[model samples]
Target: MTPITEVEGRRLALSNLQKVLYPATGFTKGEVLHYYATVADALLPHLRDRALSFLRYPDGPDGQVFFAKNVPPGTPEWVTTARVPRSDGPARMVVVQDLASLVWAANLVTEFHTPQWVVQEPEIADRLVLDLDPGAPATVVECCEVAVWLRERLAADGIEAYPKTSGSKGLHLLAAVRGASSERVTEYAKRLAVEAEEAMPGLVVHRMTRSLRPGKVFVDWSQNAARKTTAAPYTLRARAEPAVSAPVTWDEVARCRSADPLAFLAADIAPRLQDHGDLLAPVLDADRAGSVP
Candidate 1:
């Protein structure tokens, strides 16, 4: 029988601690929990008050996976949850507000921690997200180039944007907004994507069509929608290698053009946090101003 691990005074029944989740790196479930716990101080701030959708892999990265919207039944009452309204109906979503909750979620093998753009309210969006996904042969290098272009454009409009590695072969740029309506943000993002595509002809694709993707980076503006969720920064991706959705500086983003796409991994996050702190911290500053108004 697996013994319960005590973290921050919380007794969690952790199982398969030695089970390798990332076969390539031989990263175990215990390591995953440790990573979350070590980074909780920086990570929980981003997740606080946000509705989280869990992508669980019970049997590690090689096994079948499922996403849990509503906190699974039998969740401890001490763990926080928020009632969020969806198209079909209102669903209760887990809100990771503390270290205990974060560790608990990690115990569930929640590899991808996706959170809504809005906070507690479903209508208000606090940030604008731009997901730059490169199709085959395009590579993250193209995504980096496109991101720099977008960042400069936003800067010209007096907006400050934060960039991060998507933990996979993509990049995510986010900017703090004044709790704007999701529809407004979505429209604004779509228009910006179109404008970017126009500015860089062969480099950017605004639409979601797959065939149009090859050799082009897809500017996924659709992530701004109210129902849409993006992988929270610092969350580990469910890949053969334990890569994390690490927040990066603009300088790092620029350098990534010539570096490996998987440069940032689970092992790299702690050292980064120690050296640079949270690069995305400004995204949570409610008073910070910058938008395409």
Candidate 2:
């Protein structure tokens, strides 16, 4: 029988507690649950009311992986859901609003993803994320240079941006926005990508062509769309180790001499959380938002 525990009045049957999801480090499923519980306070606010998607690795990171947008069968009745219109019809996605739901989902998935808009207002965007992915020859060390440039450029336009490691292999620069639709934000993000490319030729590339990304930082601007989702801040990435999509300080980003400086593992979270409770917190305040310029 699976061990049952109650979290905020919801009963959850946790399975495979000793199952290692990350064979590289022997990180177990139980540790994954614990990590989410530890960071729930800071993570829930970002996930609240947002439609979630996940990449599940039932057989660990090196095994088969599948992307899931629709909530799988047997999801608890307590889990809030939203039916969003898609090309094939309406698909139901999980909307994790509480600690219980987050833990339940964390137990089963390797990564957590959320869109820029909330379920209550799917058409409106609350944040804009610029995904700065480094190409093979260009590492995240190089992306930091681009992020610093983008920050100053955004600051000039009165938008305050925060930096975070992608947890995969890049940097995600996020800024809060008020009353803007995803379409408008997407366009604005695209424009920034183009401008960044022009300003730093050969360093930044806005185009999505596979070959163009070889030695440049691909400034991905399309994730700002209502339908697309980004890896939620604090979410664990399914890498060789249990690395997290960690919120970072500008000081760290600017002084990053190598990729090692920016990389953060799951164990590093609690300490940072204690020192700086949710470095991404400012992006949550709607009042602190800047217009999509």
- lDDT by residue for model 1 over 1-293, one digit each (tens)? 97877767878787889999888988998999899988888898898888888888877778988888888887878888888878789888888888888988888988555544545568877788999999978888899999999998888777789998888889999988764788888898898899999999889999999989999999999988888889999998888888888898887777775548435888899998999999999988877856546
Candidate 2 off by > 4 Å = none
- List model 2 lDDT by residue over 167-282, tens digit each: 98899999999878999999999999999999999899999998899889999999998888999999998788999999999999989998898999989999999999999999
RMSD (Cα, Å) for all candidates, in order, is: 1.5, 1.0
Clashes of 1: 0
The top-ranked prediction according to lDDT is 2
The TM-score between candidate 2 and the true structure equals: 0.98
